[model samples]
Target: MAMMRNITIGQYIPGESVIHRLDPRTKIIATFLYIVLLFLVNTFSGYACSALLILLAVALSRLPIKYILRGIRPLAFIIILTLSLHFFMTEGHVIFQVGFLKVTQEGVVRGLMMVSRLVLLVVGTSILTLTTSPILLTDGIESLLKPLKGLGVPAHELAMMMTIALRFIPTLIEETEKIMKAQMARGADFESGNIFQRAKSLIPILIPLFINAFRRADDLAVAMEARGYRGGEGRTRFRVLRFTYKDVVALIFVAVFVVVVSIYF
Candidate 1:
């Protein structure tokens, strides 16, 4: 359950900071550019700059550093696994060996690079979700995809699906936690077990979790229908989105950061 609390994805913290006040579109575009630059850059110095940008943004947002770092804890295993893969597979001068397994100098360098990339990718984009509310995020996505509608894309539906998926992540985690506790009270052993045994023990939990998930989804659909919520066709928003000077400034800042890091260090 503590692991669930550390997940910052799909979670938003309200604040009066400039980061929070910028249009969601600006945040979304900046996040996209940041992610693109992550893959394009090949140097540790570039990753360092990316890390500093995230840190500066976090400070400007008035959010606790620990709060932002919490998001990485849940994905720590994946990061470690990624490092292991790079460290073992890349070929170079042998640095260490164990019973036919060789660790290379190039592998160490590549592994650390991969680890840096993964960490920055997570920390950089997390700022967007931390500062922007789900509703505004959905609107921003839809607005950005609006141009694709002329090319036969279901922009509104696509945005709705993405938003719903993200919005339900916390809900699903809470539901799973609840079911696990309930099962534990009934003497189910989910803890002390080998890998296989632990996975097998989750059967009782997954069954009821899926049922509750589907039931909730159906309930939401019915409620929407009852409220006359048809497709996004001709739909009007209660809160309209507008691009202001703040958004322009935010874009310019991100553009400069991404360009400088991509071309230089």
Candidate 2:
């Protein structure tokens, strides 16, 4: 059987650690900078430094190591595929050959490096989302994009939409699972069927799912209007976000990590 779809972007866990307490804006900026720095890193030393920083962050967040690794389990196959392609396709003095396919020392090195980069990229960003709440992330995004309001952009509206979408992902997933189970109970065998049969079986689940989704959209619209929701006009937040000393310290640490990694590269 296929594994259940537990892996998602916003797998947040509430906590009171230093990393958890930093403003969401700081985490967003730091994650962006970290990704940029990952590309700048080319040498083993650079990778080592980046790995150390990720580990430090993971430890500080106080989340279980297994949970973090589990989040990346879904990406394992993609990482393997990437490594395989890089290993077999790149041209060099062949270390080994299988018919027309050749493998080289450079290919091996490049493949390993590519896999490592992808793993680090996923795990590091997972840390950001794992610690910060989706609401905080959306709020930070709106605050950061506020300057665009001068250009007639609807920053708050966009952020609100994103927040709602993020909020509903798990709910939708659960709904889908329930629909699938209900169909299964009615002898809708999705697993032991031909392609056409499987497609036909899904129709029952899809129809109800779509109808429910539309109903949810309509209800949300009505609720928003009932609450006097306007498009970012003189809106005030219930929880006013403020940057604290932890944010400053996290930025400083991030800057140092970038500098050290750059030097290593």
Q: Kindly report which residue stretches of model 2 are placed more than 4 angstroms away from their true locations once superposed.
A: 1-9, 151-153, 177-192
Top of the candidates by lDDT? 1
lDDT (10s digit) by residue, model 1, range 152-206: 8888998788877887888999989999899999999988889999999999999
For candidate 2, the C-alpha RMSD (Å) to the true structure equals: 2.6
Per-model TM values vs. the true structure:
0.79, 0.88
Instruction: Provide the overall lDDT of each model, using Cα atoms, as 2-decimal numbers.
Output: 0.88, 0.87
Runs of candidate 1 with Cα error greater than 4 angstroms are 1-9, 96-99, 162-222
Tens digit of lDDT per residue, candidate 2, span 120-219? Answer: 9999999988999989988988998989889988899899899889878777888889998888888788777789988888899899999999999999
Candidate 2, pairs of clashing residues? none
Top candidate on TM-score is: 2
Q: Count the backbone clashes (under 3 Å) in each candidate.
A: 0, 0
